[model samples]
Target: MSLNSLASTIEGAQLVLRCKNLNDSINFLTTRLGFKVRMIMPSEAPTIAVLSAHGCTVRLEMVPNATPDAAHLRLLCKPALLPAGTPPRLSGPDGMVVDLVDAHAPVHVPPAVQEFVLTRLAGPESWGVGRAGMLYRDLIPSRLNGRFVASHILLPQGGPVPDYVHYHRVRFQVIFCKAGWVRLVYEDQGDPFVLQAGDCVLQPPEIRHRVLESSGGAEVVEIGCPAIHETHGDPGMHLPTGAWLPERSYDSQKFVRHVAAATPWGPSRLPGFEARDTGISAATEGLGGVRVLRPATGPANAAVESEALGAPGAHQGEFLFLFVLAGQCELGSTVLGQHALHAGDSCVLPAGADYRVSPAPGLELLEVTLPARLPA
Candidate 1:
C-alpha cells in the first residue's frame, strides 16, 4: 500500500464492432470514415476485419459468422452496452462506424454521447477471457504528468481470475472493484485481501498482484498511468523499478511483514497507500505524489461556475488529457467517428493546449497532469 511507483494511465481503447455483414461494415468504415482495413482473420466460416487507421493505439475488429446471428456484432456493441437495435443510432441502416481519433495527445469524451455508447455496450454477456468482463470507458491522457488515466473496468461472469500478474512497459495500474467481490494475492504475502465493488488497490511498480477470478465473474474499474517506464537499480536503491515479487505462502508471515514494512501501506495500512477525497483535477501528479479522488465529488469538471477545474475559457497547463471515467460530459467540439467517449474512451491534449471540460448529468471524469519536463 505504500505509494509504489507511478501507475500507467490508459491512452485509448480497442473497440470491436459487429455488423450484419463484415464486408459492409469494413466498406463503411474505410470509405466514409477515412479508415483503412486489414484482414486479421480470413476464412469463409468467420470472416475477420481489422481497422488500424492513423493515430489509433488499438485496432477495431469485425468478425462474421452465419450461425451466431449477431454474435459477432453483439460482442463488440455489448461490451460498450450499445443499444439492442441493429444499426446503432450513430450510424445509418448499417450504423455509422468510426475509427480512432487523436484526442489531442491524451484523450477526451463528452457525457451524452458516452452514455449512448455504454447503453449498448454493457451487460453480463459482453465480458471476455482475461478481460474479466470489463469494458474500458475513459482513457484520460496527461502530458504534464506523462501518463494516461482510465476507469470503469467490468469483470465478466462465470468465475474468479487465475493467479496471475500484469507487467507492462507503459502502464502502472490500480484496480478497483465496482461490483461483486474478489481477493488480492501478492507475491510477497501469505494472506489475501478481499475487495468488493468500490474498493480499490494500488499495485506498486512491477509488483505482481493476483486476482482470484470468481466463478460468477467480477467488475473492477482500474486507473493506469500509461508511459510510466520502470527502471532497474541495485537493491536498496529508490529508483522506479517494476519487478514482480515472487509468490509465496501466507504461513510465511515473516516475508510478508518484511515487504509490508518497506511499502507505503506497511505498518499503518498493510499496503502503504493514500486516497484523496477532493477528486482528480490536473492531467498529472508530481513525481512521487498520489491522488485518490472519491466517487462523490464526481470525476473532473472543467467548466463549473467556480472554475473548479480551470477557467471557462482558460488554458493554463502545458496540456490536458480528458476522459469520461463514469457517467458523461458535454464539452467543446463534436467528437468524430465514435460520436463521444463513454466510460472507457479517451482524448489527448495538444502541448500547452487550452480547453474546458463539463460533466453531464451523473457524469464524472478523472484527469491527471505533469510538467513538460522534470527540473534539473
Candidate 2:
C-alpha cells in the first residue's frame, strides 16, 4: 500500500535512455563516463548497448527521434579528466548532457551549529534499517550542524553479519557496546574477538575491519566527527593479517579495545560517582576519551572510597555526551531546565554550559568528551 512496504521486494535500478545515435552514445558513455559495455544487440550492427559502472546499469536504446531529458548522465569524477578549456557540462553527439563533478573528495566538517539536545526512543519509527541489516536509532538527530554524528545501532536478528571488510574516512570515531555482544575482526588484530556489554573500541580512520557475527539484540553506541562521510569497501583485503601489531598506526591513530570486566572502578571528576577509564585518552593522545561512570556504592568501589567525588563536573571543552546506561539520573543546567533520563536515553551539552547531574545508588552512565583531559 505504501512505498515503504514495497521497498523490501524491490531488487535494483536500471536507467533506460533513448538515443538518436547509439554508436556515438556508447562511445561517450564508455570513454567520457567510464562505463563498460555489458551487452549489445546484434553481432554485426548493434542498436542498443547495456553498460554498467559505479553500481549502476544503463541501457542506451537506438531511436531515430527521441527527446530525452537534459540530464542524461551526471558523472561524478575529477574535473581534470576532461579536456583543457572545457567546462564541467558537456553535450555529447547524442544530444545528452553530462555533468562532471568530484567524487573522491576530502572530508568536510561543517561549521558547528551547537545546541543542547536530548533524545529518547519514541516508537518503532525511531529505528531504521542501516548497512548490514542493522537497525539504527539516530542519537544526535540534529547532527550538531553536520559537525558530528552519534547513532544507536543494533542487530535484532544477529548471526553471521553480511558486512564486508570496510573502512571510513573520518577524523574521530568510536563504538561503545551497550547491550549483548558482537564478534568482530580488524586488520592485523590477530584474530576475531568479542565485544561485550559496557565495552568499547576506538576505530581509527581508515582501519579495515569486518563484523563477523553478533548475539541477538546486540546494540552499540557509535560516535563520529563530521555527520557525512564515506564507507569504502575492501572486499579483496583479508582480516587478521597474521601479524599482531598493537602499536601499528592507522592514519596517526591506534586501535583500542577496552574491556569492562577487567577495568577497576576509580575516582572520577564528578562527585558521588566512580569512573572506569577506557584508556582511550592515552591511545588517542588526548584527541578524545571515554569513561563509564557510576555512583559509588558497596565494596566494589574501593578505589574511590577515600576520594572526594563531587557533583557532575562542569564539562569544559568542545563536546560532552552522556548516555544513561542503567538506573536513572536528572540533568539540569542554568540554561536548560531539569530533565530526568532513564535507560537508553542520551543527551549532549554545548560548550561551557554548566550542568548538574542527579546521582542515585544504581545510576551509571557513559561519558565521552573531546580533548580527553579538560583544562582546569
Best by TM-score: 2
- Pairs clashing in candidate 2? 271-309, 271-310
lDDT of 2 at 196: 98
Clashes of each: 88, 2
**Candidate 2 regions off by >4 Å?**
1-104, 297-313
Give me the candidate number with maximum lDDT.
Answer: 2
Q: What does candidate 2 score on TM?
A: 0.74
- For model 2, how does the per-residue alpha-carbon lDDT over 58-177 read when each residue is reduced to its tens digit? 867788888866446655555444455656665777566755555555677788665899998678889876665688888888888878788888889878997678787888899999
- Tens digits of per-residue lDDT for model 1, 303-333: 3311223323333333334444467554443
At residue 203, give the lDDT of candidate 1.
53
- What TM-score does each of the candidates earn? 0.39, 0.74
lDDT of each: 0.37, 0.77
